[model samples]
Target: MDNLLDFFKAYDISLSQMIIVAIIFFVTIAMELSIRLFFRRYEKATQHSHTIKILFYLSLNKPLQLATMVIGFYFMAMHVLTWFRFTSFFDQVVTPGVELGLALCFFVLMNTFLSRLKTYSITKKTRTDGGYNNFAKIEQIHKLGQALTIAVMVFVIAAILGLKVAQGVAYLGGGLAIIALVFKDTISSVFGGLIIYLDSPYAVGDWIYTIDGTIQGTVEKISWRLTHIRTFDKRLIFTPNNLLITQAVVNASRMSNRRILQYIGLRYDDFDKFEAIQKDIYTYLGEHPDIDQNCLTLVNVVNGSTDMGSTTEGFFGGSSLNFQVYTFTKVTNWLKFQAIQDKIMMDIGRIIYRHDAEIAFTTMTLDISSEGAEPSPQAT
Candidate 1:
């Protein structure tokens, strides 16, 4: 050790400074390894927990390692420069650089911490009952938190660089004004997204349609400027958020039940069976498991004549007797509702057959009098 110090001393390098640097380097590596091992154990222990899974996804190991290295480098530089008698150089360049690096490390740590916290909040909320009902509000808060984190980071960086916060904000405000002017539509879309986030009209995975019937699809994602929709035909659409704000959208996924409306007609010959069949159909719907009995259900005869300007009772030009059936099904899923409706219709057909009644169809009957006197001869 004495010979090694003598060799470095001849080159004006202090062996003690070199030893300090070596210690810092090894200590930094040790800290990094310790953090890595700790996180690995934590991940294994909490693997089954979703909250822990999210935390693992947003782990602080990387930032913590970076910060440890930065701190170690700062100390090593300070010791080496002091031993070299470069006090002015250390004060002017090294000190400020170290401060800047430390500030940046702090910013990164804060950003990561904020992100982790926000993600945890959202994940926790999603696991609760009726969580979807407040998802939009939580999402909005998350976005706001991110923006604030970025703003605070910028302020800290500026302060480290000896910039006044008020001056920096003023410059930022002016720059933003110009940017807003240059990108008015984009800004509008951003505001539109904010409105959507706050209003909670429709959310991700909702089946929605425009009132004009032009756009109908399931919402896949909602970003700052656009909303992604997957159409029923398997096409993806990127629609501007502002456009959605201007239009009326129907959220089909929010419907409590699906409606079933039909008009059933019976042949006039089966008039005697009409009253019993109608009553039976109503009773079936009221008692069906798939039907929502709380909603409006109706099975009533058409009281007016089918012909225009006629006042006949349940007679459509004496061809058939018609009745309307209106009801609601408990299921709102498209495929499930269709299946239920099909079963109900088939059951109604069976009921009609059991009552000895036939569904009506258009038919014609003709009679010719002898006044024409043009009877064809028998086959000759």
Candidate 2:
């Protein structure tokens, strides 16, 4: 022990300081292990309450362990630096860097905790007002916190290094316009994202259409700069957030029911049974399980497309009487509603067939008279 003391003394580390550092190292390890064991026991003890267990896991365990280790190391280094009288270099370089690193770690942990808490809370609530993810608001707050952290770190570092902050501020002021100009698009997009998050225009998994119908798809993701859309044809498009803000968007996902409107044409011969057909079809629509009972359901004859005063072109060749069917489905799902619609149409066709009626067809006929015709020379 005497020889070891002499060796350390010669190397400028007194035996007492060496012992203190060794003790700190071992104590840090012991503290970390203790924290882990404590959390484990606490978890077992509080297993009946999931929320409490989650709170403990999220808030206390990791942060406490990290803080214990970091504080121990920081104080240990300070003690050594003080003993060695390395104040100049320590104050200028090491102190600021360590403080910045600690601040960053704290903010990162805080951001993670808040994010997890938000996710848990939102998931438990059964009601949704507009969008699927409520986390976007939380994400905005986290980003703002990180930005403030960075700004504080910059000021702290400058003060530690003895730089004149006022002069730096002046310089930044001079270049502010250029910076703003360079980042105008990016800044606009960021604000646009914030507006989108706050306004709840649309959310991921929602089907939206631009008012002009140029863009229509399900929202896949919303990022800082762009919103991704996955179209029905399996194509993916990235649209700027600002453009979405400026344009009008219609969210079909918000609709409570799907509307079905159709026109069915029958041959002129079936005109006599039109009254029966309309009544029967209207009754069927009212009885259909998938059709919304509370909404308006109509079955009546409208002027056919071939009506003299109308200009709408008929898919059926020229002249045919048409009946209109308008109803709303109870469900908004496309596939399920399509199945219901198919069955209804087939039933309508069956009704027409049962009445000895046929669907209209386009036909043409021609006739000629040969009373005064000339013969060709080759016929002689």
Off by over 4 Å in 1: 1-11, 14-23, 50-59, 76-134, 263-269, 301-322, 358-380
Query: Each prediction's TM-score against the native?
Result: 0.74, 0.69
- What is the TM-score (0 to 1) of candidate 1? 0.74
Model 1, residue 91: what's the lDDT?
A: 84
In model 2, which runs have C-alpha deviations exceeding 4 angstroms?
1-7, 14-16, 29-62, 79-84, 87-98, 125-176, 212-214, 267-269, 302-321, 339-380
Which digits, one per residue and each the tens of the lDDT, describe model 2 over residues 143-251? 5665676687678767756789999899888897687689988778877987887787777667888999888999888787898999999899998888899889998
Q: How far out, in Å, is residue 173 in model 1?
A: 2.2
Per-residue accuracy of model 1 over 110-215 as CA lDDT, tens digit each: 6666667665765666533211233566566666766777777787778767898899889999999999999999999999998998797887767889999988
Report the number of the highest-lDDT candidate.
1
Name the best candidate (by TM-score): 1
Count backbone overlaps in model 2. Answer: 0
Model 1 / residue 361 / CA error / Å: 6.2
Question: What lDDT score goes with residue 145 in model 2?
Answer: 62
